[model samples]
Target: MTVPLAATDFHADLDLALRLADAADEQSLPRFDAADLEVSLKADHSHVTDADLATEQAIRDILHAERPDDGILGEEFGAEGVTSRQWIIDPIDGTANFLRGVPLWGTMIALAVDGVPQVGVVSMPALGRRWWASAGDGSWTATSDGARRLSVSTVDSLDEASVSFQSISQWAQAGKTPELLALAERVWRDRAYGDIFSYMLLAEGRIDMVAEFDVKEYDIAAAVPIVREAGGRMTAFDGTETLSALSALATNGILHDSFLSLFRDLPRA
Candidate 1:
């Protein structure tokens, strides 16, 4: 006889994601700045460290044992299983920074149901912080101080918004340098806080917007739920809800349209 499983228990799933993140942290933190850490390049020429590999493997092992039926799509190991319930993971979101001893890197874990992300956890052990959210549960962060709810900034106008577009090179490479420059000129402030950190800051109400190019599904999947649950909006640069989009744009819900409008006339590559 087969037993019926709990029906889409988001809270329980979120708890599991956090536990996976904890395991990731354990695998990553010890190698963060290790002098002997191994580094290599992927087919795309991007860097990958030992920490990235080990962390993803650790998370994958847990998922294999605990949630055998769920699918997994990971940056380091590629995809496994085929199911509506999928776990998307980026064991180390900022490997470049992590390799250089920068504290801006983190591990990202997310669960998607029918292709819609319903849970997310971003853990930055080096920064002493982590953020998590699940469908129907508000976004939250844990710091040395303690855990607290998170929210996006209230700034409603581009002139008053603080934005980060990851990096100018990304826009330049995407053939949208002029557009990016124009946006920086229009926003109240602009910084290249690049990577998963920018979205975390946006979710914490510390920044107003984040847009980036050349992102992958694993790069933005975990961020979707955290930003959305924190009362923000995230979409492709063309203003569609898709993680596979080549670009990503996120902002306080109020400023989403205004931000999208800036790219309306630009041609996509």
Candidate 2:
């Protein structure tokens, strides 16, 4: 049952992405609130456990069987096969939250059309919520028990915006730490959502902006469409149309150009 890549109808693909997210949820939710949050650290200084690997492998198997023709790029398994229309997966996006019973953790899935994500899904089983959007359908959030629409806030100025930056180290690694600090100086407030959820909050209008450096394709691929469709904008530091693996900025539409100007000259702090 290979999922074909014949220019997926964004609406249909977004629906399937959420269903795929459900499959991941089934594998992750029970372990999420486990009595013991014990975890083993990876050599790279990051963390992973059976839940992360298992959830990702389970998703890969489903993608392999359900969309054999479609390619996949995932955090746990790396990239596989060929197709411009690949599905990006971050099986359990905030292991720290999952490990600590924080409930901000979630799984991300997105269908990239010729390298641009056109359908995105983010599901947080512990939180009992999920959000999704396609190129044109707009973003939405649903709980295991209900439904609701999500959109960014109308905060137009950086001084009024509620923003989240994934990590301080992420920007430092890219030599954008100074730029980040400057932006921080201007914004209302900030926190580190550290993964997919920050972008999710941005789309839901709960957070106004998110910028991160040193990320891979799987990290931001799934959030682009959801944010864009929710009346927001997402692009690289240069304000390009394409979402890059290196860096990304997602902002409510009202703050797009104004914020881009911040990146014009990297500050030295």
Report every candidate's CA lDDT. Answer: 0.90, 0.80
TM-score of each: 0.94, 0.89
Clash count for each candidate, listed in order shown: 0, 3
Error of 2 at 183 (Å): 1.3
Q: Which regions of candidate 2 fall more than 4 Å away from where they truly are?
A: 1-8, 33-38, 143-146, 266-269
The list of candidate 1 runs beyond 4 A from truth reads 1-8, 265-269
Tell me each candidate's RMSD, in Å, in order: 4.3, 3.8
